[model samples]
Target: MADVNCHKVLMKALDYDERGDKEQAIHYYTMAVELILSIEDKEKREKMNKFARQALDRAEELKGIKKNESPKESGKKSIQTQSASSPTTNAPNKTVPTVPTHSPKLEVTSKEGYTMEEKKVLEKTSTINAKVYVPFMEIDAKERFNFPIPFSDKDGILELSPKQKKEFVQWMRISELCQQPEIIIGTNPDYHAIKQTVVSDCSFVSSLTVAALHEKKFNRRILTSIIYPRNSKDEPVYNQSGKYLIKLYVNGIARKIVIDDYLPVGRHNQLLCSYSNNKNEFWVSVLEKAYMKLMNGYDFPGSNSNIDAYALTGWIPERISIKKNDPDFNGNQVFDRLKEGFHQGRCLITVATGELSDAECDRTGLVSTHAFAVINMAEVDGVKLLMLKNPWSHLRWKGNYSEQDSRWTPELQRILNYDPKMAQSIDNGIFWIDYYSLLNFFDVFYLNWDPELFKYTYCTHKMWQSGIGPVKDAYTIGDNPQFSLAVPQGRGSVYVLLTRHITSIEDFRENKEYITLLVYQHKNGKRIYYPHDPAPYIDGIRINSPHYLCKIRLDPNAARKYTLVVSQYEKTTTIFYTLRAYCREPFELKSLDTYLTTNLQVTGEWNSSNSTAGGCQNHKTYRNNPLYKVTLANDGNLAVELRAPKVFQVGLELTVKELDDSSLTAPFISKTTDNFRSGFCVLDLENLSAGKYLIRPSTFLPNQEAPFFLKLKSSAKLQIEKEQ
Candidate 1:
């Protein structure tokens, strides 16, 4: 009989098949076949042949079927039977509402410059509770399912908690908010509609500004995508669902934020932060409420607009720093890149100015250390002009293109698409700037690319266990998950995007997830261990944002398997992550969690303190370092390697001691050499005694945590200490 693990994998394959995912089903089926084939015992193999044969047969049949054809309709025999609770049964046909028969032409597009892939990813992550919230759907609005949020006892039989009672009693109906609270989220999400109130979250609002800027050119910002009962005017119809769901990409996966209508109200029911200027337009207000709920409260320490852009659009942000005085500075090239990016519908660009004094900000008509959205660009008769939008409604630029200036003539206004009437209004946040003035004022720009740039992408969602007792950090090396990516031959770009999920509103906390992505190539034509090399294009160490992105360029010579290590500096809470690889061609991502070996071999990727942080080497940090404990029931040999970034040399030191209770100590062993490739410490012992041993691998470089491998070969069993 197959074991539980094997059985579960096969069942997952069956489920994927039922969901119209032939490719994923095939992957799971192949995993099942490999699992059984790995059994060494002859008796076990014979008994498991039933399962192994079934997996192979199903895989073959599925492969033979055309992708466009359904396997169930092909009438082929299935190796694994469907489970009992497959959710397909004869019911009233009312509960499981059928999706209305709408053609693809009915699909709505957004002005966020979303490519096809970005749009699809966004749609998948959004949750539509049409029966309750979107009553305009074919489902009946009065038919309430679950009451969405569990705040109070509906029966009135039990005592309500104080918090719940307050929320229940103070909950204002959507109908009572205004004389005519438009069901529509907004006429259109324009800059004027959003206003930052008490909370400090301009980065998020600036992201909305960018999303709102392109609606006239594209479709709608993701803001309106999840709103229910959108009327013919592109406004949402208000109903009694009393709840709303907004979609955001958490760590790479789409997570829905469920929120009730119990918004924080002051003397006059004023929204706390990020509200619309139009009194009755509640989308911005509702969105802020849902976000606060997701954040757990009113704690918005503020973050970069790029970070919020990723959550909103599912695009990976690229950071480009400006050094104006550098000899390599090319203003024309930068301008051309931005121009082409916007024209090709490939990027949403936003800029941040250097810190400004309060007086300077007010006098110069700019916000201090504020973010601005790039809406349009033009070069009319050799004069470069950039259209921008300040999230703040009144801070108009006082530069050459200022509203008070004479530069806004007939031809220039037409080129910049400026409406002189609207430009004079304080509520309209739009403005245009001279090309030279833009480069002088802005310090940094954030660019998020369209998903269509990558021909293929492979994404996997996982959870990393970090920050527990004692050290309160993640395992230094070894234990964290590693993925082996085989980048096939090509001259293309690849990006590894790591994203973390945002928690519920009341459960929100500052993200303490610091991650680094490292890649290493194979050596000497060996297949077992692919060591780390200081490769270029890796992201910086310890990025605290919800998302981290690193880029790698592949060429004809870069066709090989590279090991990708996802590591953390310190662990706070259990972090959920999604690892996404975007490339021009299809690639393979294989997990190396179970690829354990006892042979005295080499492992680990190469890294250096110069380019990246060297791990807990003595020279890097004098005290409080990482130590790995390995226990041997019998005699064994341990190899500690120190490899260089450029050269293939290795340096190492090995120390063996018994557990504190054992009261035993071995010789102080160390090795060094001036010869090339001489930095290696190998312990080759014969008739080695069997006992618990603590092996501390060190290097000459102080406080440097260089990558190394520990391979042990012994007759007796060996066990590394349990990793948290």
Candidate 2:
């Protein structure tokens, strides 16, 4: 039976391979390989494994070829060799530029008249055309139809709390509720028709509302672009096959999300999910269902609209907190920036209210801890006013510029281009409020900017484990993930965005991780020895949000290299993150791997018997610390780092002296860290001659028992051993 199953899967792989569907071919080949390898009989397994392995290898090879082929070569046959004959031509043979096999040699000339060598150095330092990484392939939707509701077993329905589950009910399809169901009701999506229901996804609904408004105002497809199975006009249509595909930018890539038409329905057919006001329209409900499925169902523990907008459209997310005690909170400047960006169609804005008291909520006619979409911004008669929409499509702000406000007049209405009588007729949740009232009421401003505003973009995905670095990084940042950014000598700006990958719903509830980005002005991409040894160029405030944006302006005359450090507070779990950089000018961004070609590491411990835990230079037993002799075969830059438990302060010192020398005087070529730091410290020696040197690793207190790691990195061949 297993052999027959393997043969069937192999046949499917061959069929897909012949049809040029590399993704499916690889999938079936992988299944066949797994099945063949699982056979208990060794002889049978070996016989089938050979064929399965060959098929899998061919499928992987096809995938690689497809990945390397450019879009222009889509329909053309892939050339296996470059030696094939070329068409005869009468034109003179043109010189074909030679491509470098390794790191390509850049021919960029600086306008500052730098020499050839200087240009090469500049090119090497600048990260032009850096590779953008997609950490994983698009996720399989894993759709299931075991039940009429058609819910995926992998992404089960929301596990609501005991109290909430009592009110919950079963799921129903759109066709069962409406006689004539349509994906969209009209030519344009009606922002006013969107309504949030029982699901605790107000932020996501608000995101959809503002996104719909953008599509209506600009006559462009933003929400509809992600939905699959479109008609001839490229508009999303109802799928009779009961399946849909949504492309959402999650983790580090735009992943495909497959869902069915079923939606949660409560008693009396009161849709238990967000939906469009038009009874016949299903796009709003379908889109919400797809997103909620990605988030593990309708029992969403709320998020901000900027995050949702980013997932829907790969935009840059930014959040500005408005606080009474914040000295740097400039309300006017924020409004002006939002006004310019929004009107230019480069920004999507949303505002959220902080936790308000019951009295405050009732008096102001605002919901507590709710998100509102910012639809319009206008300055009329020096009164800065913004138009906002509530996802509920009913309750609105009862402020100065509201519908029944006393400040409304014919002249003022004409200036603002708003009709009070028309607006007062229906409570559509859309209302205008003064800038002062907004600042006083709202606590946060969420902005999602179009990434197309910049030309060059790069992304890198990385993982940081909790045990690898200190839990609280207050004193030293040696274990933090660092990157080197080489900016060109020109006037431009760079934006670095850090996005944390969330793997579960619990990540949205308590958010234990607080992360931020720090930039330092270091030369030659050297590792930072101390936190404040070199003051940070841009010190960012740590926030728990999934996205953090760091913006830096480039000085045309300053040094071209800078270091970006990722810092976290009280890290408790491993985190996978993506660092995406966007800039108008080309620059180089690469991970800082400072380990030299020749590396050596050893582990030792401080004990009372050895008296090797000599305190810093101030201790009497300083000379009893662990000593090692380092022998260099050639001149090279050497780095020595001492690492110990966070409970102890560690330092390293290098001196050119005999291992048996008992002289208390310091050697002429001695190099040491200025201060002992908790966890780790390093000393860098440059242009050292080929010779032997003595290194001392010490703790802050003598007789402190703890294990420590000594690392030696050099550009040339070097050897290190314990010196008795």
Candidate 3:
């Protein structure tokens, strides 16, 4: 009943405040608080506290604004303020509300009267609600997590009580006043057998340690390390001769501390005062105190469970099934424990691998761990030398110029701080390379890989002047009587300098994808692909049609031979071809070999039996049917001959088509010109790169005034053969 009444009063207050009725809002706020005090149920305490906070906020706002009015508006504003200050301001004294009382403070003292000043503790309004008062002194607990302070010496231990922990935690949260502390956990193994047998003794531990040792005149730093005795002869050895480089972790940061059998003269088999020692008693004691505080299910700084730093860093990999060799042991119990630790991000495991080779390591010059190899970039005896240690800790790189040697130069002596003569190099005896050298080496090698690629295109003068200048061209070839193609002129000029001489060709045409012609002129074989000297002439060409619209690759060696086979399911159409021979002076082909032929057997001949190079020959009188064929001899010279073909006209036609950006069609060469050939026409095809394109050609029948759809039985194929 009380909670319901409190809720109703709060809702009414909210409505009054939203409607700008300040006096009504105050009346509702006071009613809500009064209703909350009437509730006896513990569960209703939270509701009461919420109502109290709202009422207090409204009162504070109203009081603060009361004196902020001008003299002109004071008359009206003062009356409004007084009416809003209290719910029953207009009522008699009998209707006045009672104000809530503040909580009382607690005091404590020992029997001997050694009393500390009464530190006023914060009040607890409910089980989960409390207030924490600020302390007079400020202390730093940096890098310390789950730390515990000694309470035995203090006579009045109010701060050590469970109530104090809760109140202080709440106060810290509400006021955002608490500082974070660092935590450290460690694990290791100790030798417990006579012969140090396998799995003789080992244990793991996790704890929170003191960040720094605080004393009157000194502050000492304690680092954490996990150590294990390892054998050198073990396969894929981690350590040999019970010596290992202990992995040290400080505040989640990782470092390595070398541990071996060597110690001060008389100390044997005992951990020295080095950083790798197993003295973690201080941390263990602190954890026990913190664990006690956590037992009551309270969430204070020292009472909460902690997570190791390594776990948060995601160093642990995947888990594996455990196996055990001992008959007395349960199935894989040890492995299960280790696996749990790994999954919980508690274990920090380092994989052992061999050092990368000089080339494998890249430009960084970084050396990987191979059990005992040292890759310090520090200087020794004025010379930078990599120090490697054998896992046995007995054998080292103690050679001629070693740290203890006398043959070292002044630079080397200064680096190693060792001298057979005067020891001028020994300052503090710390190993170090020149700072600049170390920086340069690290920056060059350690940086990640990032790279880019660039491309360029070139053309020739004749190709540009012919209106083809490296652009798309359409040619036709097939069983049709005539094949034609048209090439469009490009904006750029392709000068003769682009192709002064033939070099070598890089091409592939066996597959339908990525067929291109690669022509390169190499001077010193610097950028050349072929080893042999090029013949300084064009070599191989393969294209869709028998016309000149095709790419040619130059073969540095000899006359190139290429086979063009088009496939349809299980069948193939073969088209064998060769280029005409040109003059020795670089001009187009000229000679009697270009014309009539008497004997079909003989190949290279001018004005004789087997020639098909320069001019067109009539097949009706000279041989019933003639075919112009280009062939290459075994001696590397090109030849031409005329043979009989099944069809009358063996040449293709060149057609040109153009379209504007708006798709408005332009006239083709056939529509605008009359000097066009029927059977075969010279195609101006110098402009074309590798990309998809559409070609539309329109034609008509002869003697027709108006043109009609002139479709020809034609097909097209693309080929680019590399020069041999």
Tell me the whole-model lDDT of each prediction, alpha carbons only: 0.54, 0.72, 0.24
Candidate 3, residue 614: the lDDT equals 19
What's each prediction's TM-score?
0.58, 0.73, 0.17
For candidate 3, give the lDDT.
Answer: 0.24
lDDT of 2 at 598: 82
lDDT of 3 at 548: 24
Give the TM-score ranking, best first.
2, 1, 3
Q: Which stretches of candidate 3 lie over 4 Å from their true place?
A: 1-384, 388-395, 408-415, 418-724
Query: What's the CA error at residue 452 for candidate 1, in Å?
Result: 4.0
**Model 2 weakest lDDT span, ten residues long:** 95-104
Per-candidate clashes come to 38, 2, 50
Candidate 2 local Cα displacement, residue 312, angstroms: 0.7
lDDT of 1 by residue, 570-673 (tens): 55566666677777766777665433335433323222333232322324442233344566665544433332211122333334545333554444433322
Error of 3 at 35 (Å): 87
